[model samples]
Target: MRHNRTQHRSRRGTRSITAASATVLAVVAATAAVQSNAFGTEEEPTAVSQSPTEAQAQDCGAGTFQAQVAKAGDTWKARHGDTVLYTGDDMFAAMNAGLDSLTPNRTTKERMVVLGSGTISASERLKLPSYTVLDVCGTINATGAVATDTGPIFSRDTTDVEVQHAKITGAPMYGMFFRSVSNLTLGQIDMRLSGGLGIRIDNGSKATPATNTRIDDVYVSGASSHAVETAGLDGVTIGTVTARDVGEAGLLLNTTTHAEVGTVDAQNVGTGTGYAAFRMANRNGRIGDGYENNIHVNQVIARGGGRGIFCVSESGGAVIDRVDIADTGNNAILVENCYNVTIAAEGGTVSGAGGIRIAARDEFANTSDVTLENLTVTDSFIKESPCAENTVIKNVELVNTTKDVC
Candidate 1:
């Protein structure tokens, strides 16, 4: 169900952060750092010096690349083997020309590398074909308005595509958008945008739901919408979604199933609204007619935003292992009209937030098989209102707070 953004309630007054809250904050920061560094833990030996383009080419696996784009003076050049496909001022055009020059209907993957940093005044998106890898080793400054359905980079009806090391700055409709794609990988993307969404991956219809998608280490700031959003996706793995001052959820899963998420670290996201740091809606985690624990999250951290974790509109079957939430404007954790949900399976802490809530709307079935355990709540409360069935609340420590359960 779509939320009414116009009807926002007043936020609770800010509370002083205690020593306990500070400790939780530190833990959250450490968790984010650990996740960000997990893939780069191996030390690299010192090697011979190389030019920036040469080093970037090696990083992009350019030995297997069939096309290349490089900036020279005021112009960008696209080349394949000995053929110069394009030489122009538009970086986007040069990159696209490099892709278009590749041999079509190839059985194996074709790689392309953008060797250096440049700015593109693009009103259109750079599209990716199937069985392709586009490694952009340098920053891309995308400037100009785009159509509502397009973004800076997009792919549709594609299979086995990867984009690596993309650092973008713009207010496009989306930083990256992919639809009806299978076996897609987005690695180490950083977006600093002023408006629109950060990343969106979905199937245009349920008949062709995207499958086997992996997103590793994305950082988005100043976005007008969710940092990462997925709809109609199956078998997806998300490493981390880090958000700062985003207008909506840090990571939102809608009608998606078979998901594994590492961490969602958000700060000042969706203030004064019902959007959350992590949200599941539109029957997420559903398998067949029953709900399964298909959506698994390792950790979630939120500070000074709206909700911390939200499961609404018959979405559930998730196990959120840990959380560190503080000073949220709306409910710290809310499970509404959901099923088979468990929060803080390991342990967690919440402070100075609206606390945890379990509610149900009359239109849907009551939330069932829900558990909230192993949590320490400080300066907040936990309540199960109009209590549902088989709801479990155990091993909870309340400091300056109370629990009203039925």
Candidate 2:
């Protein structure tokens, strides 16, 4: 699948902030600015609440055109203008009630601001509809056993949906999940939990892939699966993916094309597995009927991970411009059964790692058009085994390193 399509911008507009909401808006704007800087993008960042104090102080319930769910002692209240939609202790119910009060079948976007932190059962999720924006200023702590393929936040087959300033904790099947969604934006999300995947987006069929997705400044810690994973996505833009002590890859892209990744910073991720800080599998970067350098990464910093970078399973057409990796358990960088792959195009360093390797499996075509240039390798090696074709290694500086090429 060639996903070399132009990214479409979201049609959401900014709302006027009152003096009372200035503090909350400032915090949200600051977080988005930091993410934009990290991604090296000039696009305006999405606004989100950063802390509990800010969430409480920002009484979004007072807005003329927005709905809100606020905690009042032991009970929660959902209101829109003069209408009181629901009042209960169940946060999930309160949120749904608030959402139900919005303009039905809205051609334009409507806002739902959830205030206060509370526990939502793992089996319960806040479902977002089209032309909807949900901003949770407080944390959502998930409890109980999750049903099959469930999460704290979910959206399916929706268009123009955005979630901001969401802080999710506790163990759920998935922190946040979206299926076949288009024009989606996730900004300033923080997931600190044990087990489950951090964020997952995918399409149900290969014919209809999710289009124009943007993820800005997501922090995932202690996830058993990938921090951010996308499948069958076209035109995806990621600002930064930060992972710490994660069980799998920091960012894993499968059957995705036309991806622009800003930075991946990972530490102690996928310590003993074949997963890498950044990995691409199952025709990740293929463009059109052939392959080109459609997948571009600005930088990657991996320390004490299972692997630094991996491109396998007939996936190729990627250029990782820079990398800084150290002491990885598996190959620091591995390109197997791929094509048109380039590593360290702008120069980088690999020290005390398992070294770089280029190989091919019998099940697929040999790895070809692979280039490794402008790199400094220390206490490592560079090997090209059972070799490929049109492989180039240039301007490489080695210290106590060996090369085995065939």
Candidate 3:
């Protein structure tokens, strides 16, 4: 008899679970191996030999849980050993069914591995279950005619989910919107021509913010809004992100803590009233609450449209090591009412016509305790307003211009 997921969920106890358990479950699920079989024919489902690429894809992670999935007709089927656990029209449904069929225990681990490469044309949002790995080697395209303003994958309260090697296109709102998800990992994901934000990670109305989130090797292009936006996130790490042709900011972080980004390359960002390629602000209005702290950006390269880097609040300190800006439509760096911030460009190039602009918008606005060091601007580096009290500049070099030192 097939298991009903709704009944299983209803039977789940309300026992308190530790946050550490989510991390352990995610690691276990991510390392599972999966072997592929061929399907999608009028004949009965039969096992075909796995190809070299299929075997290599399964080896991406390491674990003991083993499962197989195949495209059978218009539906997808998931199996563990010989038992067919779930069959559905979309990958999310098949994955949820496979997870529901698993025996609930502390020692048991589960994973769903995609077999064939095809597109899942989703008309509605796909919500993922907790403590499971959705390894999609294919693409998911949203084809809804009505703009419902939803992401392809929208998770409200899920935990420990890892989505990898997938491409999402044509989402009406955000390509992937994760809310209140703990221990989430998105690796090698691509979003193209998204009508709204490319990716957004936020914990809405949750007591604990989203923690231990990692996004690596992501490429978002042609987004109508920000390419990657995050808020109410803690212990987040992003690496090798490339956002291009975005209508708004390339990457925006609000009320985020303990963030360490490796490299970001943003090109041709901002359409109307957009801020910058990278923006850091205090959206929660929790000043000095220690919820927004310790943001470190290693490398940044921005070209064409919008400001280069914008610090829009007096909260959330940041340390930027290197920046390369060119063809910026506004100031290369705009610091307004920010504190405890340091922007240092060591051995970097800034060829844009606009330079760093630091000022206060109103009486309450101020920029202080900021340090600019070791920067080489190819054009004039102008100061929009009077230098803030305690502002420091060191080893600055300007070429092909007379204005320097703000």
Candidate 4:
């Protein structure tokens, strides 16, 4: 194969390219391969087939241009195998288009790996092969654009896919999306600097948990929004979700199904510089639905936001346990309109405003069966305390003063 190089080219974001037409980019470090199948006009060619011009190689046939990239807007059709090394800006668009053009069938064996300094913006969505494992070991920048949600890595009706080891910055929308997907895994993925959350799941209302999907060793910083937002999902796992220096919440686990978080360290997030962490010891929509969903926050270190643990406008049942909120601007744990939610903060220090604001709503009439077990509130003063009615508390202390149920 021959090395190819070029400059500025774009078209929405989900265009395709032919194998014979794809440009083999020059590389500092990355490996690539190229191959294809053969068909015929009269009788079919054997194992291999030659393009009208030739293959994507240095030495073409008798009279043909070598494996140079076709002109801009040119596409390769039905090309399967590829080894592409991308460099320079706009590689995001280039690579996305190339992968889309491949258009493999529903077979779960297609694979893609991109390695380079990829920087770009987009106005469209890109689709990858089903049962595809697209590995990106490089850098990507797509910040500053409103979420056209214009996707570069999207897999619908796909399963068992994995994306790992990449620096993805400035997502116009979701860093990665899985719709109707199963057993998907995003490993060692880093999304930081500008735009929205590092990752998000549609488990609460819109989409399912993309079942058996686990995001591990993911670190996000400087988010225009949450470092990671998981909503309306079930059976999802976040290994080490860490976010700091962000806007909005650090990690928003709202209206979810079955979720298990390892270590969540969110600081300096929300509005501008606040630490509104999570609330409700349990953040799940319950066995009440007969699904028996479960959620747990193993270890949390939150600083400087509104409420450190917040579960507002959530229904169903959940359990939250063992959270630590220190030096926060607002409440340490607050739950509003939560039903059958049990919160446990035994080994924690809540030294901030509104330590635990679990209410039935703005009034006492709209209450649920909520419980705060083994919680400790130190240096806490009411940021509008006197937590409404019909709430149960055991082995808990409300220190530094407030109005009680009197």
The TM-score, computed over Cα atoms with residue i paired to residue i, of candidate 2 is 0.85
What tens-digit string does per-residue lDDT give for candidate 4 at 1-406?
1111111111211121111112212110111121111100111112234432122221111112111111122222222234443222356455654465443564533444443444566344446546555545445677445444454466665666655344677655666655656666665566766665556555333444446556655678876766776655555666666777777776776556555666678776674433365543233454333212255556667877666777655443455567777767766766665555556644555665545666545532243556666766777743323444446677766677453441
Candidate 4's TM-score reads 0.68
Please write out the lDDT profile of model 1 over residues 79-128, one tens digit for every residue: 98889999988888899999999779775677787766777654688888
| Candidates, ranked, TM-score | 2, 1, 3, 4
lDDT of each: 0.78, 0.79, 0.64, 0.51
lDDT for each residue of candidate 3 in 336-389, tens digit (9 for 90 to 100):
766656777354667767688767656444566666778887865757476565
Which portions of model 1 show Cα errors greater than 4 Å?
A: 1-63
Model 2 off-target regions past 4 Å? 1-65
Better of 1 and 3 by TM-score: 1
- Quote the positional error of residue 71 for candidate 4 in Å: 20
Tens digit of per-residue lDDT, candidate 2, span 23-103: 334544556544432312112223464332233223322222367787767788888866899988899999899888878
Give TM per candidate: 0.85, 0.85, 0.77, 0.68
Give the number of the best model, judged by lDDT: 2
- What's model 4's lDDT at 52? 20
Clashing pairs in 3: 31-62, 31-63
